[model samples]
Target: MNYRKLALTLAVLALPGVANAHVGLHTDGAMAGVSHPFSGLDHILAMVAVGFWASTLGGRARWIVPAAFVSVMALGGLMGIYGVPLPMVETGIALTVAVLGLLVAFEVKVPTAAAAVIVGICALFHGHAHGSELPEMAHAGGYVAGFMAATIVLHLIGIGLASLRFGKAGLIVGRLAGAAVALAGAVLIAG
Candidate 1:
């Protein structure tokens, strides 16, 4: 991978105005929703961490964990849309990154169902955040689809990274990435 090109691409995608540029503002709902996840470093990191942790589990968890996250996330989105209040959503999201990154860094092993539950709880906060940001004028269905697609894509990217082979180097790199994510979460909390 061309590190420079990747960095530039991510930088461009994460511009401040991107997340607030909702479909109700100017663009179509789906596109707006799709871009929203990439706009926030917090969302992006936590999502990718989900995939990293899943891949680390190395079994049926590879699929079940992400599936559970997506499924429960939808329910959380509905709760947000319906005006259900979840306290400390931002705190929850940041803590999710820290916890998930620790799981990846340490190669923690837990039952698949337990892992699913952990990720599912985190996904609820994420989904609710997305839903709360939804524009009234936007097509709700399209917006939901867009964010969900973007989220899955991010997860896949993390999974792909975890699947690569650099011999023993891969483990080191993975742990380093996890540490970076955790540090980012700490910064988010502090800032």
Candidate 2:
């Protein structure tokens, strides 16, 4: 879907988002909302995997799982914005990457209620990382809104990617992404 254009657009759009620079966007784009998912490899991979697996499952889960993650992640962002302290923010983010990656790779199936809780918890960690990393000039609310919006878009992109007719090739690539994410998580934990 015009990935080259998208990448170029993001580079231009991401310049002012200096705060997101910690994860490697040149500027602090505290206001990009759901699109924030692509700013960092860790966030992008895990969030995409979430969407991919959700799509794979189909049914109510197709939407319910990602919805749960976004809802709880909003709450977590609120907590962080309001100055609530969460220990090991980085570690939590790393663990989420690893866990979700594995979940996608293995096609782990859990009851809906349990699945919701798992997604919610992971979302909190993700949101908090976004909130805490905001640049100094950006308002907390605006910044959080921006990253949140960016995040949702990333999920949608993942869904789109999964919908492709790559057959076994697609599955193989998905598994590789998961393995890479898990490996990154391990390194994050070790650090």
Query: What local distance difference test score does each model get?
Result: 0.80, 0.72
Candidate 1 per-residue C-alpha lDDT over 26-140 given as tens digits, one digit per residue, 9 for 90 to 100: 3446666677788899989988888888988978898789778878877777787778999999998888888888888887899999999999999999989988888777677
Q: What is the per-residue lDDT of model 2 for residues 1-191, given as tens digits with 9 covering 90 to 100?
A: 67457545654453345444366442334544445566788888778777776766667776688788878888888787777898888888889888988877776888766777887888998888777666665566666656666666666666666677287888788777767778887887787
Worst 10 residues of 2 by lDDT: 25-34
Candidate 2 residues lying further than 4 Å off, grouped into runs, are: 1-36
User: Which residue pairs clash in candidate 1?
Assistant: none
Per-residue lDDT value at 112 in model 1: 97
Q: Which parts of model 1 have CA positions greater than 4 angstroms off?
A: 1-28
**Candidate 2, 89: how far from true, in Å?**
1.3
Model 1 is weakest, by summed lDDT over 10 consecutive residues, at 14-23
